[model samples]
Target: MTLSPVPDRALAELGRTEGGPDTLALLVRDQDTRRLLMLRAVLDAAEGADARVCSADARARVREDWALLAEADRVAPAGGGAAADRGSAFPGDLAADPASASARDTARDTAAGPTANPAATAPPGGPTPDPAAIAAAAGRAPDQATTSAGYIPPHPPLSPARARLLHPLVGPWARRCLRELGAAAGPPTAEGTRELAHDLAHFSALAAVAAARAGISYAVRLPARDGALVLPSLGVLRTAVPGGVPVDVVHRRGRLTLRQSGVADITVRLESGTGAWSAAPAWTPAYALPGLLSGAGPMPLDDLDPYRTARGGPRHHALSGPTTLDDAGRKRWLHSWSAAAAALGLGGEQRVGEAVALLRCLVPLADPPGSAGGGRGGGSCSGTRREAFGAVLSSTPPTPATFAATLVHELQHTKLAALSDMLTLHHAGPQERYFAPWRPDPRPYDGLLQGAYSHLALADFFQRCALTATRPAHRESAWTLHARYQEQVGAVLPTLVGSGDLTARGRRFVDQMVAVHERLEEHPPPRGQAARARAYVAAARALWAGRRIRPTG
Candidate 1:
């Protein structure tokens, strides 16, 4: 069965509550334009919410068209005549039939001298055809792009909104190259102009996909909201995109076309065939639409074989350490990510900041439960220097919550890895192994710090989930989970502080953590759950003590 990341049933569950994802339900009856505006307000309210996932340009464009539609509906011509020409720009009343739309575009390109932007057209309230969807419609599986040797579209054509959103981030460079290349030729040739338009559209699509996958946020500079817009340097872009081929520019007549021979299929169209920008446009914006990548749902783990040793990522020493999952395993893994994203308020921040990509290639462990993989249960890895990140599940997690927590745990590591690169956390301390509550063996001080911080983050996650949980049991369980993590950090925090191995900077960082922990502890977990948390901590320590403390003569 095809798994939906957020099914109607899941939304129904959220709608039962008064807050968080609950707000989405209220938007159901409103027009898509108004729905988008209302949703933006919610995304803006949350601190550190990744609003980049929604395209402001798309929203603005759609809003304008929506206004026009309202006007048309209000003053339908005397005979209830046809509305004004909406064109194929914004999907709504204006959406033309596919064959006719295609014919119009060709005619427009031929007659309009190609200066006009070939706006992506889609049906109202439907998903815009992305490459994957288009390819699927064409009888090719979405994975064909990866498995096949030749270029296949990376993703369906980005929606007009997404295209506009990504333009500012990468557009200037593309425009500059197009201008320079096109300048090489004489002025005003229809054929050349069309090529330039094609190149612009193609390059725009390529850049959009790259930006989405890279997970970098571009804080667009706006009046009254001047923040840093982080653009990827050429060097960074090389590492972030596949094949990393520099976009080759070619001049024809009076226009320039981008040659992406190796990276994408030349013949593929970048517009959605569904005619709708999204099946659930209003909900998607509030939920951070970009976070919902197409074709990312469940697939057999073995299908990832092509990417196991794929070029153009962080170089790993080992190719195969974990076993590949069968169909059942893939379903479980897919469900876990979907459930976690839904349960936790991770939509805005799903791929923001430190996350580059949500890695899914799993290598199962041969050793039997709990005792296998050197006593390590499931472990995840990410390259410290690059944005290559993913998890390695040694075994299926007992619950979706467990899998979700693991994802958060590993993401914390990536955050730290990125932070460590910017600021030195510790001095060159002695290479001495210290206690890590999770593992049986002693870890270095650095390792201990990462573990402790991750647990602290775990505590934070559960704490937040508890705040929004409607069910009494879920809330209590969340509190209990938080307490357990809080207790784990409490045990390890002191050793880290007293180790006398920390640099001044490291000490300050640790101090901040301690302060946060103290404040969090003040809001104690639900009564019985607190005691249960303490007991759980005690039990974990006893297990560790027995395993680590032997006759060390």
Candidate 2:
């Protein structure tokens, strides 16, 4: 799929950290487009894998399921219509009538291109077609070129939950399995092949899960993770036994059931028009952030997925170890969230709305060591990753104001991450070479850029607080913070503009940032606050310089 270039206006607005909701939506859509391309690549590799990697039956099932899903996606109404009525007639049921199924397959294949074999379409219960043929009909070729109009409508838009499943965490796993299957020098051992097969099957099961959640009526076997059947964005069904279980998921007439032999069946009732789920006691519901503002719906808390963090790596926010929130912890977070939402509403509704919209999930982190009951002084830190779009890993903030500031700061990072994906901001270079006023250790250009951009938002946020704050102490604190970040951002923008590493677009982007910093200067901090902020900046730079080690040739 070809990515359309971001318009100049959109880039400028984003550079100002003021893209708001509409521009953010465009960035999100681009990420989804990239995900679709990645999905196609995974499918192509799976189709080309050695036949010995998976059993013939497993291969046939995956292919047939994929074809049926493609057909359903084609016929589903635009904008996802009514939840109960949308894609209600399961494509699997088409197997009963070969003629109808064949016709549907032919239509899908015809739309894909000349590479698709219309005659090789697989009906659910009929003889399975060649895996390659099935792939050709359902998946876009990696080399295929198409305009936006032709590409987007042929496939279904990913739900937020489904998109999370296809994140960067899964990419390496899929690549590893593909490498094992494609090894030509020596065939893998039988045990290794079987393991690879199981791993690859997870992708197919993900497709099945997506279909089930789209209100499609169907019964299919899905592999479980850690003895639990996870329904993305919904809930999990934990079996009594350990290891992965092959669970049968059946969704019919607004009711979904999970069944595994020797385990109690779990049932979930899907709300008629809303697509919300009401599950049995055995099902562990996923945590979802409540809709705190009008027209801003709930977002997943994302604590359940094993892939929530990068595999075998340190947690993103090191100050607080990453862990799932307990019942008490969750209650605390919700209470803080309520206060935070109220604070944000008073701060600026539009800004908070846009920031919240870009956030897909909030992964909770444990409070820092030596902090009692996760007190406010524990020092909260939030982080965003380039590969994990829309996810924010953060420790719970101590105050409503701190929470508001954290959201704005992280939103800046999230926006920049998305922008970097679409456009080249700076060329890669050596690390720990540039000074960042916010950090003790020297940073690379990219880190410096992220810091400068986020600090820009923090300065803007504190400026707003200073103007609106009613309490004298609150106003004074806001002024000091506003002045501090203002000085930091002012110091960094010129360095970025002259870095010699930024692309033309990057230079333009930084110029927009400069404009914002200059505007903030019009209302300078109070005399005492400015003096304190300048002294603080000088001390920080001295400390960083003292810590830096000069290299000897």
Which one is best on TM-score? 2
10 residues in a row with least lDDT, candidate 1:
281-290
lDDT of 1 by residue, 230-286 (tens): 111111112113432344322122122233334531111111211111222111100
Clashing pairs in 2: none
In candidate 2, position 221 carries an lDDT of 70
> Which residues of candidate 2, in runs, are more than 4 Å off?
20-22, 50-65, 68-205, 271-281, 317-321, 339-342, 345-350, 374-377, 428-430, 550-553
The TM-scores, one per candidate, come to 0.42, 0.76
- Candidate models: Cα lDDT each: 0.38, 0.61
Please give the RMSD to the true structure for each candidate, in Å: 19.0, 13.5
